[model samples]
Target: MTLIYQAGQAQQTGQIVPQLFVSIQQPSQVALNGVSTQRIGIVGTASWGPVNTPVGLSDIAGYRSSFGEKQDGDADMGVAVSVAQLQGANDFRCVRVTDGTDVAATGTLSGVTFTAVYTGTTGNALTVSLSQIGTSSNWQLTTSHAVLGSRAYSGANWSSLQAEVSADGSAFIAVTLPAVAPALATGTVTLSGGTNGGAQTSVQFVGSDDSDARTGMYALRNQGCAIGFIHGLTDTTLAGVIGTFGMSEGIYMIASGPSGDTISNAIALSASVGYKSYGLKMMFGDWLYYDDDTLDTVLISPQSFVAGRLATLAPSESSLNKQIAGIDGSQKAGLVSTGSSKTYSSAELTELFTAGIDVVCNPVPGGSYWAVRGGYNTSLNTQTWGDEYTRLTNYIAESLAGGMGAYIGEPINGTLFGDVRASILGLLSDMRGAGYLDNTGTTVPYTVVCDTSNNPQSRTAIGYLQADVQVEYMGINRFFNINLQGGAGVSVTVSNG
Candidate 1:
């Protein structure tokens, strides 16, 4: 993209070159835009809403609007959304899935029956009233729930509107029509035989059928955002989705292990699907406040918080030990508790940390939420991946991709290669200053290999451009030691061990 300016008036002779009184567009040294690391997504069943579609919501209200107001049968979705919002996450996407066989209730008047508009339990509360609009056979049916509305019909028999129109309904009773030619009689009616077939299985969650746009996970394809969290899907199911259906566009999928799922189970799931490549980070049993009225124990998914935390932090900082927003101060919320009544010992926490499972501990002195174990990982090979590290590499890769776009189809020449190398080095220098790289003005913490030795004629002929980036992201100091030395004068000095 190039810009040309034509705003300077013709000056007499070589007048003092006015600084153009314009904004001087300098070549950007700092990356103007970086790969977005924040956008989070979730897939699950809503009490009421469209199925298998990615809806980006602004806040709790936005979510409720798209996924129907949260209510019974919402599972942990409402809690997760609340937690996510509290964590400063304003950008999110939700996928709603429901049984296709579910049926809504219906009301009848003058042979005309109106069925619930959508299939969900929330419709069971509808109150449809059948009353004469004036003083004639012409009657009006009004529904309490907005899911349905008032309808006017003129028919002598209740079955007259035989063509069943699924208008809408609620648990409230539907008023029965009067038998007289012109009268006002109302009776509550409960449309029976409505059954929500079943809960969504793991397979159903991976909806690939985009025909009607309701393939659970598949509904988020080309969603144009990195999926920060996979929500409440099981480990095995998540593995299947990642191993089978991949998350393109360099997105990582945050997963969770509920009460029953063991750390080993989560690890096996990670290994089974080649999780390293898939960028799947599993959070094994983090804590959250369940009941607001009375304290109650419930397994709250941590993937949402993990996503929000990472999204909330600077690209160079880690989301570890960060307090979750709401639960930080909730008296009911406590740390590292498991359903097995077993607390993970210090050593066990160490093991889980290496295995790519994030854990939570008690509140940091002034913090509110439970502290997140560093919230990212790859496989069980502990040394290989870190969230911020992986994110840095991803950003650089994406940045380089756009930075090097000018040479996409140009001839493979020295100038283009040099330009690409310079761009890589320049970005690395910026990272070094930002603390993403550990270069100490001497030792380079990264290696960018793009010289002729590797990219020879044969490789370039096949239309392949490659960059080998090596980054040594800093790791947590799990162990440290100090030695104390005592002198005859009763003086003690500390020395590094």
Candidate 2:
């Protein structure tokens, strides 16, 4: 009799019987897909939701439903998301931060305790009521909130009433019934004692990165976020810290200085930080006057606006000359603070830029519209200063990191090198096709080398396989100059094709 063994199963050794062994192998060609470069990550305070847990938000309604509305401060996560949404950023991974003093609002009615779903002052707005249905044995339970709206449940008995509310209840509150059922009664109980905790410091915002329990900013790791910002954070001391995090995690971080800060102060702060990296983009605090739903017109930091604008652009595009949406005016231009409209002079802007600071102001190089003056990061190196360098480099690096693991266990041979090189070339070609890479003319925009030259016998013996890649990113037109000559006696020359 003939016997067959499944793939990956061992066959008996030295057996006289005939046996057939089958083996299955993964496809040699690996297709690399580009990671999403548009998703923005935000770490900030909120009135609701689990603390330090990353939540995906696509719209303002989802943000409100998950994280509650904007709190009464500048660090609200919802406010950041709202402003970012104005710049056409629809994808977000938001992490809510809170001090340990936060408390969930709760109330008791008919021997049932209702608690807010998450810890925040937004729970204080909830009210629950129980009433008899038309004087019958049946009863009705209703939960209401000003922002979350209202929901009602009807049931013939206590058990049924609890089930109905549990099945289709308000997302804002959770109902807990007592051990013993109580008779239905008509009364309203309002939740109170809810607190939003204290303001967060930079340490809390950075959070811990323990593999078992990540919190705050570290909670956003591996969330596929290409850009991130900590709302209202202007601490110069922490710039390098956050910049290092961004560099290690392949995320671009947008940071800012204090709103209404002076030019000298901004320059001094940048110099004091002194840490330069392409992973971070620091903005000059030309505070913007933004209309908030809860706080009315407030002067807010410029990080969220910058992050949103970057999120709306392609990986290779720059923020310079790109008009930012939903900005009522800036402190300098709108006269909100000084009672007089003041714009940055060329010399003042030059000083700020020289100090590695960028600002959003009126009269961009193109026109009088408000736009980013310089599309640059904190890096002093000219080669890596532009926003494109950080974004496109991270985009390509992350794409490879996500796809190159397939060759880890494969045999180290010529076929492995060819596959690896081909995979990288494929992604680079796609990038070129998508206008992310370009050269002067009639030349390939990238180069890939993976073979015996770079990977010798000594390296392959130790299971080391390396593929070196070089890509030329498309350049942004930062400056445009024109020569003009006009005189009555001067001759004009015209050229025709």
Candidate 3:
């Protein structure tokens, strides 16, 4: 919409009519963006693919396409993704890690050669072919990796033809050549001599690389749909990083507690546990089930299951009392023991839950369910550690921020500001009606304040706008009581008679 041209003399009515279109300024919708509480994001190692790039995946097919199929212990990402997706997770964004040299296949024509796009041991089996169009220098070149199939290109590159590089291998690039060129021969050429680096470390999984477009869990930040990602690999170092960044960025994280030490460590940490880990936006997991296939209590973190379960439920819903997918709750269901049997009494488990360990339990012999108890929260006034409260607040606030983000650069006026205010109030009202906000007789649900008092001329001149929001996070009744008194009335009836 560049405004061009100087004012011209009234040439003719018809000439000016083309530029006389009326412009209308009317009311428009700026709906409050609701943060998705049902989506999960994750990052883990894979067989081979680009490192540190987020790939949206919904099923095993998506995983296989973006990241190659799993092989042996290279099953971390696949296993977690399968568990989450099967359990009804909304979607997963995975960043594959195959830190290795890309193997290449090459064929020289007229002293010009084509190379493999990525360096990897998987590329060693790649085959490439280029056919000269008869006696002409115009040629068609095709290259493909052992794992990744062929990429084709049709062109007249007098000099060299190469694989076009991309996040996903698709196109090919070539160099300009001289008018007079030597005839080329067509043949299948295999590539070799590439290597896969080693296994990924915790730092690599929950990374802090400044240069990465979206580093680690931060990838979930702007994605807007993901509530958070499960690091899956429960390295304490990785946990600490996610704990710090998740709260700061308004993203959440589901991580596995320290395996053997969780029991003793959780008990010892007690009230100071959240302080020890600044447990604002992180939820820790506990023992799930034994994999009979491997004849062992599986060490696979329950993060994915919990995440998927949470995503499936209402945003206001407490993850507590929810059924975790695939967890077989049994005291002595003949599950082989890896160490001491994973059987504990309800009293013992309650202590573990209060002390901050999300123990898996089977109240009824065959029905396994997550206690959803352990979390790092210092606030004793509320069940902030339950993660439901944090999620509610984050969901509401982040949603408001997202909705209002569109209006930032608009001209500041009472109408604009009032629209923004109404949008927030309406959103919160819907939240209250949906049971996502606290509207009980006891508490105020939410308050939104934005007006001239808050936005003055001086502040507006400097491009400053402010609003104050207060929200009362709803609480869950985790404990219930029942009692009977017979002495007060001194009347007792034998109903059995």
Task: Tell me each candidate's TM-score.
Answer: 0.67, 0.89, 0.72
Model 1, which residues run further than 4 Å from truth?
Answer: 1-32, 72-76, 104-118, 122-197, 209-214, 235-249, 260-278, 291-298, 328-343, 363-369, 374-378, 398-407, 418-435, 438-453, 468-472, 480-497
Q: What does candidate 1's lDDT look like per residue over 373-398, in tens digits? A: 55556555555455665565556666
What are the candidates' C-alpha RMSDs?
A: 8.6, 3.7, 7.3
Runs with alpha carbons beyond 4 Å of true place in candidate 3: 1-23, 98-116, 119-195, 209-214, 217-221, 266-298, 328-341, 346-351, 364-383, 409-413, 438-444, 452-464, 483-497
Candidate 1 lDDT score relative to the true structure:
0.58
How does candidate 2 fare on TM-score? 0.89
Report the error of model 2 at residue 352, Å: 1.1
lDDT of 2 by residue, 396-470 (tens): 999999999988898988888889999999999888888788834699988999999998999899988888898
Name the weakest run of 10 consecutive residues (lDDT summed) in model 3: 165-174
lDDT of 3 by residue, 1-497 (tens): 33344344334345433454333444544777577776667777665456666778787667755555544342256666666776688477786654343333344455555444443445556566777777776777676654455676666653344323232334322233345665566776665564556766665566654744755555555655535554456554454566666666665566665444455565555444443332333333354553423233355556666677777877677666666666543233223343324455678666665554454444423244344544333233344666666567668767877777877787787877788788888888888877787666665577778888888899988898887877776666666566867677688778875
What ranking of all candidate models by lDDT puts the best one first? 2, 3, 1
